[model samples]
Target chain A: MIDIKNKIKEYLTKKDTKFNSIFEINKMSGGSSNEIWIIKYLDNNTENKIVFRRHYSRISEKENLYPPLSLSIESEVMAVAYKQKIPVPKIIYNVDKDHELGESFFMEFIDGITLGNKIVENRSVKLLKPNLASQCGEILGKIHSIPYQNIKDLNTSTGIDEMRKYKNIYQDYSLNIPVFNLSFKWLEKNIPPVTNKCLVHGDYRNGNIVVSSSIGIKSILDWELLHLGDRHEDLAWICVNSWRFGKIKLPVGGFGLRNDFYNAYEQSSKKKLNKESLKFWEILGTLKWGIMCLKMYDAYKSGYDRSVDRAAIGRRSSETEIDLLRLIDNEDRYE
Target chain B: MNNPPSKEELITSVIEFIENDIIDELVGQKRFHAHVAKNSLQIILRQLKLEEKNNRFEKNRLKEILKMDKDLNELNKILCQKIDYEEIDINNNDLIDHLFKTTMEKLSIDQPNYSAYLDEKTN
Candidate 1:
């Protein structure tokens, strides 16, 4: 504990001379990979709330396949997305890794349901359920339409490159998961042409968004995996069965049908949606998530982060195994 | 031998204690971890009851698919190499069937309530 309160106080006072005192600093339930804290402070006798998010430097390069986006770059991307009228948190100020506060930034806090299980199944949020899928499709369209040139240091690894990358990681694990091998084989044979490459929110799914019952989606969270890839990667990633959170039949993040989602996306993006490419990316996304789960298990076995949550996530790889089988065995149905 | 509380009973008691006594008393990340701990114990209980039969079925399937008698892990390793080297047809129905059944077995031990597993089970 680096005395986060005092550090924040120093930063705030320097940024704005009128900074009076800190009121409260509450740690929020953030992504497993980062730390999020909601800070309330008074500047000139007026109270304000902002969210502080920081990347955990403790995550060794050996433990993660791709390092998360630097906070400076993330701040830039958030600014770009905000300009494009996308639902993203407004960046307040960003500091580099060399800062005593580490690689972290403060942003406006948009409150809503960020839990996957609750957004999909909670009765209290039932009012937003009907339009959730379309809203997601529209947001994804907006995300994909952002020009990639402005973003700096974003890797533009297309589907084939990503497949090889993940394959290398899986092989490094030295675990003989035949389903993963078969899925790789399937992906190789059915790799789609990269027709469009744009800004891809690499982990856009149910849990990554803040959803309000009144306005539907308030803001999209977790841009650490930001990259440039096939537009369908964002579209298909949300449809992956693992993200569905037990509502398998309703494939659009377990909220609505694919048609509604696709129509809304097409309308917003003004680009034709290819069902075949979407199916291919969906399979790849499932495999990627499965490999990620195994990575979690590897972390546990190697005593990296021995939390029960990481250990439990390791068992989830099997869920994706069965999902991969279903997608391959019954391609017609899933597509 | 431990007569009063067997391994399964002891695990069940711990799970009960965590779920009924410990979980609700906690909040935020601690509560989340407590739930994860409870689920982990439940998975152990399921594996204790199901692993032997599941492994037997999986081994038999792998043997049929690869036409070899070997330990489960060894057979799986060979199958993986075959797929990797393109020695075996990727779309072979036997391979597909075997993978599906083996995955289902693993899911039963891991997360039986997972939607994909539940969908297949109901189907």
Candidate 2:
């Protein structure tokens, strides 16, 4: 047996924690980019269990494909979000040193189900439909309400220029996925004139959210792609059809109508929901997600962490492309 | 002559053996190795089913789009080369929809209910 127990114990001791024994250490499921472990410790009649996230080289030889800034960037965003009073797990410890558990961090293991495919099957949460969009809007409003000046560490500063930043990021990343080339060209030709900027949760959709049976949205997870950008980017992301489960009618995370979500946001944030701007953002969101899937697919093909989840994600590009087409078609009809 | 085990059967058998026999008996690196092996097997199985079809359909759709927009070879090449996040013409929604429909038709995939999506947007 490989003694990860000694390694974990040593690390805990160094962190100035008095622990007599390490009872159970098992890997947790879900996460394509990082390894997660649930570790339980016994210290003087007290038992404590905490989760650890460790970044590993997905591609054995091509260890540098995943940019160095990826993990630290995510950690920085999480810290900033935590400071802004965002509902997220309290980060207990962060270690960038490869020697200590190999690119890792320790955080309070949140006890809630990630809202993924299983969300549709879970009936208890299903009953909260009408309130779901409103709740989402309120949560998003709170996130967007964070003062831009306060979040100094967020690499990208908040401004109207964020649209240009998104365009650049998308252009660079989309080069790897051949299918999105046309979409990129189209986006270039139809770059909507930007008016407002806010803290955009780059991937604020169903998969990243956590829901509870007793409580509502426990926390928003996955800050790896967070950026300071247009507020409509987040709204459009939530309204994407791919996230709408099987019910296309219920646009906002497939839980409630779009107007309800918009009304809730307007009431909570006191900001107008610009319909034309939102339509443009929706197209962008679909293209972004679709391109992201293709990128993941390329990674899989290149033997970068051959996970079924990654492969499954790659297939979703088709759905996103479909959404993009529909959004574009709607725009044409109106014109 | 006996035929070689299909990719699906091979993956299924390996997963079953690991879950039933090796996983319970193993610990630490051995268990981790087994788990990784099982996951890799599943990934391979999915790829075997999906990759060929995905590529074939994408190529066919790209060709069709090129045919439709004759004299736009440069644009077609760019479009066929990659999928971009912010790379869509929101103003020319009809053209975008046509490309999407053509792609779907080529792939033999069912088109999403655009009207339903539109209704959601309008409401």
Candidate 3:
């Protein structure tokens, strides 16, 4: 095996940094898309430890394993989140050059457990049941509250014609999944004009948020999908049935009530989440998730990562379809 | 009354067998097997359960709105190729509700713990 310790030292030295002679590197678990290593540099003099993340591979090239562009997005989003005052790991260094560190950036590794699959398995998180939804809303509100002008260069804006943009993206992957096509058709037919555009975390849900067992939501992770669009997109995504895991009642990542989530968001943002607007976004959320599930399946079938999680995610397409149905049913009842 | 087993029934039987017999025996990363079995079953069931009805309903609704032939399968095939959802008319809310409800019903059965969750939500 290549001496990762010496390799890291050489790499860091080239970047003009000095740390402990010995580096302790341990691979962090989860994430089908990219390889995460928890590298702790023990300072011999100060006896202190500093951590940095290194990409396992490059984005343009295909790796036998690991996700593409995940590190690049992670590094970029971490920087953006830091600027927005959203709780996230601090970005210390970013190396995208293929010749340098092979992959991408490095950052101050935040200390918290990602509430991804563990949210469904961990019984301990039940204690935070009452406040979890509210906390999620607060964090999301903070994310959406980011100024649009600051990140204009990122091309995050959805533009004036939101419906047209959504239709194009939905159409791109609607072929294999017909139900989503129909849902998109429905959303198009009932185009609720966008009132305001704000910073939207395109993929905000349980899997991305990091929380301490005792401290609640420590930070929100994963901002690759961050863009400027209808603010309600994030809200609808959190409540989407597929994200609820197996716990359907607690719509907010299956941890808290929908009413509570909406109330909390309203309280935090001082903005009303119109039921009509929310319903439309919820349908869009279901369609988005359903298509995403199909994409994972397509990737796997086409000889991409054949991980168990990707397969499981593929099955969730049906769950999102079911949510789409329920949302339509609820809309019918109200109408 | 001797028709062959429907595709839906065959898929359901296969899923049941996997869930009951094959799942436990096929160790080592059984999660993927479970997922494949469940989704394969769902796709087949959805085709059997909703394909005909959705096609007919969507066709009639489209015909009413666009003043075209009520050939839904043809319309749907064309719709599938086209990427825009706004092209479809939404004059008849009732038809939209029916199509939406049917899709949801098909999906609800496929959820891992949907029944228990529904019971809790309803209560």
Number of the top-ranking candidate, with lDDT as the measure: 1
Write candidate 1's Cα lDDT for B20-123 as tens digits: 99999999889999999999999999999999999999999888888999999999999999998899998898888888889999999999998888878888
Instruction: Tell me, by TM-score, which candidate is best.
Output: 1
Superposed by TM-score, candidate 2 places the C-alpha of residue A128 at a distance from the truth, in angstroms, of 3.1
Instruction: Give residue A48's error in model 3 in angstroms.
Output: 9.7
Query: Against the unseen true structure, what C-alpha lDDT does each candidate score?
Result: 0.86, 0.63, 0.62
Per-residue CA lDDT of model 2 for B12-108, tens digit only, reads 9988998899888998656876776666566566666765675555555555644443333454555544334334333444445446544453223
Angstrom error of the Cα, residue A15, model 3: value is: 6.3
Candidate 1's residue-wise lDDT over A1-335, tens digit each?
Answer: 68877787788779876554667888766565677888887756778788889876477887876866677777788889999999999998887778899978989978788889888886655556448888888888898888768667877879898899899999898999999999999899898966868888888998998988777889999988888888888899999988888777778887667887998999999999887788889999999999989887888889997899988998989989988888888864543
Candidate 3 residue-wise lDDT, A1-335, digit = tens:
45655666666667655653445666664343455666666555543343545544433333222223345555665677688777877877776666445555555656666656577556667677547777888777777676556443443444224445545544554453445666766676666666677777767888888777776787776565566677777887887776766666577787777777777788777777777777787787777667667666666766666765665566667666656655765552211
TM-score of 1: 0.94
How far residue A17's Cα lies from its native spot in candidate 1, in Å, is: 5.1
Docking class of 3: incorrect
Residue by residue across B4-56, what tens digits does model 3's lDDT show?
Answer: 78666778788888788777777545755675666766766766666677556
| Candidate 1: docking tier | high
Candidate 2 docks at the CAPRI level of incorrect
Q: Report clashes for each candidate as comma-separated counts.
A: 0, 16, 3
The best candidate by DockQ is 1
